[model samples]
Target chain A: MKLSDMQKDKCVRVKSLGVDAHFLNRITSIGITEGTTIRVVRNDRKMPVLVYVRQTLLALNREDCEKIEIEEVA
Target chain B: MNSIALLGQPNSGKSTVFNALTGARQHVGNWPGKTVEKKEGSFTYKGAKYTITDLPGSYGLTGNSDEEKITVDYIKAGHADLVCILVDASQLERSMYMLAEFAGMNVPSVLVLNMMDVAEDKGISVNAGELSRRLGIPVLPFTAADGKGYDRLRDLFETELSSPHLLTSAPNLAEAKSLKEQGEAKYTWITQMLEGVTTTGSLDYKMSRFDRLATAPVLGKFISIGVILLGFIVAMAICMPFMMLGSMFPVLMNEPIANALTAIHIHPWLVSIFSLLIPNTLYFSTAMAAFVLGVNLVFGYLEEKGFIARTAYQFDGVLSKVGLQGKAVAPILMGFGCTIGGTSGTRVMDNWGQKMLAMAIVWAVPCGSIWAVMPVISGMFFPWWGTLLVCVGILAYVFVLMWFVSLVFGKKLSPVETRTGMIMELPPYHKVHWGHIVKEAFYKAGDIFVRAFRTVIVISVIFWVLQYSASGSLEDSLLYKIGTFIEPVTKIFGLGWQSFMTFLSSAFAKEAVLGVLNAIFVGQSSLLDATFHAKTSGVEGMALAQIMSQTIAPAEALALIFACTFNIPCVMALSTTYRESHSLKWTARVAAFYVGSALLLACIVYHIASLFM
Candidate 1:
């Protein structure tokens, strides 16, 4: 399922990130490897989405999330 | 000793990383021929001493912007022993494009995947080993905020330092020849490396309907105006107590100090010296300085916490109403902190048209120093709404100025095709640390005090001499005479010699007008009191109002507005303009525009108001 389709505060694991190759590589270079768990903190439509990744909080826009593919783990 | 260059895009948390690595021991300098700040700090990590240079962040090294050129030149010239590129993990694809460019440079480099916490929370994964193997460099995942991976980074540095032979070969002629041919290969390698360790997932949630509603054209414009109104209201509400505290502090500190000094049976000259130098002007100045300093600290804290940015985003539509766009937003928002700082930030806009527009608009937004004086001016001179009217008038004036600027120098907005993207990293909401706040407060206070004690003090002493030498009174001194000579022109603004003199003294420093006023009316309690005291005693005691009443009408409020608007640029702002723009021509233009427009506006307002009143 698409990561943006999940409810706020829900934990999930990555299945695939659908982003462009260059963007995906950049994500992986930063330790956003497959099988990592992420939790949605705040989901503001049209604004950047806030997520908890590897113990740090990050805010990204819809354009960024659209590139990424995800699955529900919890 | 090995030198590492820290390079990244703006707002990539590079500075935070630099601060975390080398606290308080850094030398900040301007990049050659550019105003972009260059910071260098040294630290002994593990066994080796490393000097770290924090280059100004750029999206790519190919851009024509001064920052990009500086980064590209420094790296190509082999100034850095190791180049550490800090990439935003959240925006990896965009970042990788720049990474590929770096890979082509054939320089020894390391990749820092910052904001890993954010990346993990987004359910993105990376294979660090694979990326490192493909890139032929060590890749470290770091949450720079919490000191994670810093030790591993240090170890990597030490390892690289000990084995200097592992340095990447410089770009060879053959490789340069194959640049076009190998571009795709390099990209493919990066893609495969990314795919090896990364899994993508779909987002389970979509943007809410309300979020869409907020950005709708008509609704967004209204929301934008509402947001700005709220910011103004909050600023005014907060400033009330702030000003009260500021005004009361001088009285609280001055009287007791004066009384204690008075008790000492000393010569009249000694008393005069003590009273004049200690409890009267200088003491009040210090108190005001402290107050201004405190306000700056609070605002700076707000800025660092991203409150100001969020506020700007909320009101961005209203800002666009005045011809301000995304690039211009930051500087205008910063005007709330200090106009000098805001003016300096204009250099960040790469587009010449945008930079000029931002500069012109920044002057319209009053800084905190002006805001601090609002209540005093309103309560003493005019009605309760006076301050609000002045603020609204300034905003309106800015709107018109922006329109005029666009009409003259406006370029077609060609969809703004540039690498600059506004994906601001929002940190989790956290309580502000008082330690950081207080430290920032002291730094700002010290800077302002140093400037006053150095430059403003000289101007004050010169004015003191002029007032002392005049036979009639200090009010009739040479400085006042020159000011009075311009009284006829100023009369349209309803200003007499005293207010005119205040405007003249503002050339030295805008706040100096208040200082000059205090100097002229030290013993007198009020404008009315001063006038009465001056008339009863002698020519010397005649207050500025008494002088002004002879030349200009008392009912003309527009004259005062004109004087406020047309006066010389504040000394601090002048200095900031010179430094930031690095051109005497721009500085002169700013001064001429302010003074010329002010005089013209004052005359028009005076004539219009005279006909009405």
Candidate 2:
């Protein structure tokens, strides 16, 4: 499943990023590489995920989430 | 000797490291093609000298921005033997991405994980040895603020110098391939490495209740306006007492000094130069300088304490309702005190379009200098309501200017979403540092004093010579001829030759307008001393009043307002603009725009009021 498909407040390890090559590179460069655990901190009304990556928190739009490949760890 | 380049995003504590190594010997210069500062320093570590260049903080080495371009170019060109990538430990993921980019550069580098304390506080743990093994480089965890890991960093640098090996990694390739699929690879390769080590866990982050309410559209707007107005009220409450105190000090000092000079039987010219010119210039400049600096320091303190950012965020919510946002709020808030000061602050805004728009409309807001002068303009000629109306008129003009710029430029009016939600980390609240404030006040005052002593004093002397040489009786000199040339223009404003000369001098410095008036009437007496006595006498020591009473009707106060508002900016503002924009063309444009608009508006306002009055 894509990381965005995970339920809100659920922690899951990232399996693979299925996004377009450019964005995947960018996100990975930002330390969002696969095999890392990510927890959904909040979800907007539109279900866009806001996640904490390391020490910094980020809000990713739903459209951007369609490309993130992940597995349900919890 | 090996050279190391320290690179990281801003606020990463690089300066602390630079200070620790070089002490006070760092040389700071503006980076080529960019206004962001470049800091370079050298120090001996382990008996080998190492020179380090601290590049401006950047998120990545992509050549998208000027700062990024410089960092990338310097590294790619082999300018340094090793690059020390300083990553904030607390913000490891974000820092890691940049580190990955550096790794892709295939350059020898040592990764220094700074801010370790903050990371530890947040319950985040990084196995530095494991991370180092994975990235194939030495990883040193440091807390630059407290001077931890300096020796380790030095040792790592020395070890890297002994055997310089480039790490080969396409760690970002999979993520790159996943994201874009085409693998255009505009960015360097280390972005791949970042993908392997970073992970996030589900956590619920909620906006504070206060933040939510403050950003609520309607309430936010009301609160924003109130906050801004309150800022103005607070500034005035603080400034007025200081202004009065400043006015009193000169009066007290000048009278005694003037009397002492007279008792000594000093030559009249020497007495005039010493007692009147020097003292008045010094007092007025010092007072105004102190006033401006005091207000700025208060704002700075509030900003340092995080109150301003909180207020700005609340205001941002209000602006969002009106389709405005970002750093534009700072300039507008600054406008409440002084349009010129607001214009000077435009450089701090990161958004280019916002900077230009803010600069264009800043002058439409009346500053304290104009505010203080307005009462003098209206009381002698027009009613008090006229002064209020002038302020309102300027506000309307600014609104119209803002609208025009937005429309013409097709600039998008929307709330700016900051990459980081927090404006600035608020320093721990504490008692106001009076020592720092006083030091800053003196620093600012001294800078202005030096400028005045050098430029304004010379101008005063030259003007003095011109007026003395052109006419034996101060009536028929080149000063008068120049005033005559502008007299027809001044007549519309109820001003004669003297007022015209004063208005022209205003271009040099707004206070110089008062200075010229003093030079003409006080005739070598200290201008501040004259102003003090004039205020006591209720004439306010403004020479324009005497000229107004002699030559024109009271209705021409509108003309004087126009002249005052629209005249060229002071020398400090012009120099500031040049420094901020780093373009002579823009500076000239700003000056020309103010001068032209002032002339045109003054003409229209005078003509319209002339018919009715």
Candidate 3:
């Protein structure tokens, strides 16, 4: 499912990033690669999706999150 | 002396480390032609002197933004004897990406695991020796804020500078030409390097109540406004004392200078300059410096404490309408205090285009002086309700113009790629570091003060000369002749030469517009004469308002108010804009845009008002 579709408190593993090269590189450089675990801290609509990744909190724009594919960690 | 370069991602406490290393010995200037700051300082450690260059922070040496490009180019040029890479020990997994990108650069480096105290609080610990062994470099765990472990760091620095070690276990660089490939390989390498060297306790991730309230869509706006207003009041509290001190300069020095010059048998024009103009210029520059210092101190504290970043996240959706991110909010809010501070504050933006756009939008926000001048001027001609209506109209019009400006200039400044997405790291809230905040405030304010002093001195001297007259006659001065020559064209905007001249002087400084109007419209020869008369009368504000209402027509007064309100803020703002953007062309373009649109706005308002009259 798209990362943007994940609700708050859900843990998901990054399956693939459907973004362009620059964005893909940017996310990867920030430690959000495939198989990385991310917890959705705040996924409120109309707001950037706040997530916990690699001991850091990241705010990703919702539009960009829509392009990111993830799988339920369980 | 050996040289070391500090590199890290944003908010890795690189600045604190730099400040601790080089207390008051640092020199800050622009990097050659770029607006990015270059900070170089020196420190003596155990009788060995070392010069350090604090490179601009970047996510990685990806050459994407100007900061990153400068870092990449600086490193490629082999400028540093040893590169000191700082990473947040609490978040080493994410922060190590820079070291991963630097793996194959073949430069001698030492890894600094900063924020060790924070890491310990999080129940995480790093075996620095093991990590150093794996990375083939010396590693030192440190807490920059507390400033402990510096002795060990100095020893490690000494050892690294004497015998540099290149990374032997760097990530494989084969087939990693593209940024995507490089990022993947780097992250893979970072994971492998951290294996068994770092232990992390399982920490549940949840938004605290405070953060939840701070980022709520509806409530966050009100809360942020309250918080920002409180911040502004605190800034004013800090600023008012300095401003009060500055106001005394004219009173204290003006009479002494006047007596000194007159005793020397100087011409009245020369006497006016030394006595009135010089003191006035000093007073205004001091006011500017004080405001810059206050705004920077308060906002810098907010930024340092991580609240500003939260505000950015909170307002990103709203500001995105104007092709700007949420980070522009602080600077725009600061524009109300002083545009020069706001312009310099635009550095917080991610891209140059956004910085330029943010600065342009800041020009639309009426500054502190404008707020003072607009109400009094509007109140002079119109009744209280009429004045209220005009004030509201001006604000609404400003909002419309800002939207229009973003549409017209946004695409040119910010490209689609730069606007693709926001991937910002929201740092944890930390206590304000007072030492760093004050030093930065003074440093930034001082930089602006010097530039402003240069611009003010030159402009005021020329202004004084043009307005100088041997005989105290308004028409005899060169400025009067120029004003009359331009009167015909300016009349289209419902302004007489006196009002036009007032408009012109407002660009030098906004509050001076009222004084200029009083001088010229009341048939005084020079601004110095108007000031002397006002000082003798002891009732300048009320008397001037009465005289202005009689001297100028309602339409003309309205036009002049709008025109001056929208003029290119001030000479200092222009210089600050140039300093921040470092693009003469864009700066001039924005300035021209304001002047032309300001006149156009005046003309439209005047014609529309005349129709009703």
Which numbered prediction scores highest in TM-score against the true structure? Answer: 3
* Model 1: per-residue Cα lDDT over B4-56, one tens digit each: 88988654667767876766567666566554567799888755678999987
Compose the digit string of candidate 3's lDDT tens values, residues B537-588: 3226667777777768898888988999998998878888876776778889
Residue runs of model 2 more than 4 Å from their true location after superposition: A1-74, B1-4, B10-57, B138-170, B174-199, B206-325, B338-348, B351-364, B402-478, B488-499, B505-550, B553-555, B568-589, B608-613
Kindly provide the TM-score of model 2 when superposed on the true structure, using C-alpha atoms. Answer: 0.69
lDDT string for model 2 (B1-613, tens) is 5788988765465665776777545665556645455778888876888898987665556424456778898999999899888887766655665665575687888788887776676556767776777677788888776644578778888888898656544344554533333222423333344434433332444544744444444564466456555655665565566556656645566667778888999865566556655655555555545545544555544543334444444444333332344435766777767654566445334343345545655655556566565556565566678777777786676665555434533233122322222222211222243444444445544554465455446655665455543224555666666777878866765556666665665565554554455556545543333332333233344565666555555555567566765576455455444444445654576677666666666677777887888
Worst 10 residues of 2 chain B by lDDT: B420-429
lDDT of 1 by residue, A1-74 (tens): 76666677788786776534444433443335456577876665554455666434445455656656788775
On lDDT, the leading prediction is: 3
Name the candidate, 1 or 2, with the larger lDDT value: 2
TM-score-best of 1 and 3: 3
The lDDT values for all models are: 0.55, 0.57, 0.81
In model 3, how large is the Cα lDDT of residue B328?
89
DockQ of each: 0.10, 0.21, 0.65
Q: Estimate the lDDT of model 2.
A: 0.57
